[model samples]
Target: MPESLEKHGVSVLVLDADGTPIATVQDALDLLVSASYEGAELVAVPAGRFDDSFYDLSSGLAGEVLQKLANYRLRLAVFGDISRHLRASKALPDLVRELNRGRDVWFVTDLDELDARLSG
Candidate 1:
């Protein structure tokens, strides 16, 4: 496991794939607290096997998660090949395209791409 940023007193969080979920909202909040405690400047959520629950990307739960991140002024990046999302929802694809043009949220294909986004 990666060392916790809490040990270094840096406000940064690297949320693993398991962090995404309708039921894990509390867990996600806890992570935000942990990140805050660590003095995190950025919180990263890497691409991985997302739970099937996330398939309902249009659901209020997903929006709630996004709202939470926005409320905290955290940059939210979902990294990985989301061709599945593109195949799943036409609206989602459009949303991804739109959000990609913004700085707050990014739908990236890889970590390198995510790094470029964060740096640029």
Candidate 2:
């Protein structure tokens, strides 16, 4: 599926197509390219876009994907409540907390929150 573009406040962002799971590094690369093609500075992705292994830090999928996005200087706004994953793993919550504190990555509860962050 192709990426979808949306306006969040004044900022335009690319969103992952529904049902597309970013399961590997290649997926991250594709997402970056799509975002670039859409002329978006950020990408709003649902937590469900990630594969199960992404929550399993040991699999390194999450870190690898984040690295790719960082290298491309793209911002990622993960929009969803990942409370279940936080409960399932001790490390993920801390990692998410740190990421949310940074400029490049943000774990947001919803699109409106992401839009607020983009605007404010």
Candidate 3:
């Protein structure tokens, strides 16, 4: 299930943690269409909604999905602790750090952090 809400004046579509994993660019495009139809500027997908490949940079799943979303000009907030994935990958932490510096994509630990980032 997904919920619609407003945070920091941004209309958001929040996806449930338990759902079909977003495993490909097509899945990401579907989400973008859904968010646009819902009148949302952002889609807040729980971290668990992604497949393991999404955390593996070499797999290129993250780039494909993120690029799809960015092409549609839709913001994404992948919220939850992905510490284990971060620890396993040498490049991911730095990638996430840089990504967090922008407004298009974010990897946040929780809703509060998501709200703060959106507000900022």
Model 1 has an lDDT value of 0.63
The residue pairs that clash in candidate 2, if any, are: none
In model 1, which runs have C-alpha deviations exceeding 4 angstroms? Answer: 2-12, 17-23
Distance (Å) between predicted and true CA of 65, model 2? 0.6
Per-residue alpha-carbon lDDT of candidate 2 for residues 12-86, written as tens digits (9 for 90 to 100): 464644867889899889888888887777788888888889889999998899888888888888888788988
What is the C-alpha local distance difference test score of candidate 3?
A: 0.91
- State how far residue 52 of model 3 sits from its true place (Å): 0.5
In angstroms, give how far residue 10 of model 1 lies from its true place.
Answer: 11
lDDT (tens digit, per residue) of candidate 3 on 2-66: 99999979999999988988998888888888898899998999999999899999999999998
Cα-based TM-score, every candidate: 0.75, 0.87, 0.96
Residue runs of model 3 more than 4 Å from their true location after superposition: none
Kindly provide the TM-score of model 3 when superposed on the true structure, using C-alpha atoms.
Answer: 0.96
- Relative to the true structure, candidate 1 reaches a TM of 0.75
